[model samples]
Target: MPPYPTGSWMPVALSADLPAGTVMPAQSPAGPVALWRTRSGRAAAFADRCPHRGMRLSHGFVRGETLACIYHGWSYAEAGNCQRIPAHPALTPPDTIRVATQHVEDGGGIIWISVGEPAAGPPRFEGLAPLRSMVAEAGIAALEAAAGTKAAGGLLDYTHDDRAVQLLLAPDGQARTLMHVLVDEDSNPDERIAASRAAEALRRAAEDIARAGIAR
Candidate 1:
């Protein structure tokens, strides 16, 4: 299987994992990102580093519709503009004091971030719904070896116990991968559980293969 396009939309997290008024650390092709959702439920992604004190923005908290740096209370808007500086409340913050932002899309129960300017939106699987996400200590080659199949367009199809499950992969660093499991939208609870387990098993097998240096 070919690697996912580095400049295209990459699935960073499941939509359900990021609730309103929360921030989480995520990986993008550019680097680490502070993926967050405002109280009004808008998803946004910003450079994880804070301009002031060099703190991680993902460790910050959300207030109203803004994300505030945890170290010195520097607040930033969803558009990456600096809104407030606690030490200089009487003075307006300069527009230049802002974190770099990236394009974000929330669709089909997934959250995607673009590392570069994408000509179109993220890929959509019409009848599949996301089940869960897991981090594997292996690469795409190991996954393909375990599943006996290749991935195309960042998606791999695996069959377990006569049931079909889709795996969406996002490479994280050299040998780590983030896998998102998807099942039919109309699947029952039992089937969903089974699929989740199957994915876990696959992850273990792939990791083993990677550790043994046998993945191709």
Candidate 2:
């Protein structure tokens, strides 16, 4: 993760978490978003609630390139236009029947959703590969205390056993964070495991710091 202007890109998910032809709910500054990927592996984000009956679009199913509302079976194209209405198959759904879409970008094993119109793209963690993501039950300050260092530009570099792990942070509402763990792509399995434990330890430390409100 890299810091950007208030209205900018937010790395909400990893590419592996959102497989093609699946949808998941994610949070953004604007609110919750229905993040989905087509069978062709193209990712898109839309307002989580369906305009038809207020059902969550994330609970809907994806067929081909369209997302169908689970409640009413209304199908929406990738562009968010209503393409089919099961109730009135012969009738054309009005153009007004559409879900709001957000700009999405996928690269470096991360999915970046726009908070607004970002004048830039997501950061590229060169030579590093995303390992896993975990939610920290604390704020950035707590995380800093846990790691014994403050993150710069939303990335905290933790070096242990001569191996460095990079953390990409995304704030979720308040008193919580989403951290994407990244390590060198060619790291050995043992090293990857160590990195994972290191992250867990850091999380514990951060949570403790938060609970105690004491700097360590």
Top candidate when judged by lDDT against the true structure: 1
lDDT of 1 by residue, 1-216 (tens): 335565679999999999999999999988899999999999999999999889999999999999999999999999899999999899799999999999999999999998578888898999999999999999999998899999888898988777778999998888999999999999999999999999998899999999999434
Candidate 2 lDDT, 75-95, residue by residue in tens: 888789999999898999889
Task: Give the number of the best model, judged by TM-score.
Answer: 1
Q: Total clashes, candidate 2?
A: 0
Candidate 1 TM-score, C-alpha based: 0.96
Model 1 accuracy (lDDT, Cα):
0.92
lDDT of 2 at 113: 83
> Which stretch of 10 consecutive residues in model 2 shows the poorest summed lDDT?
1-10
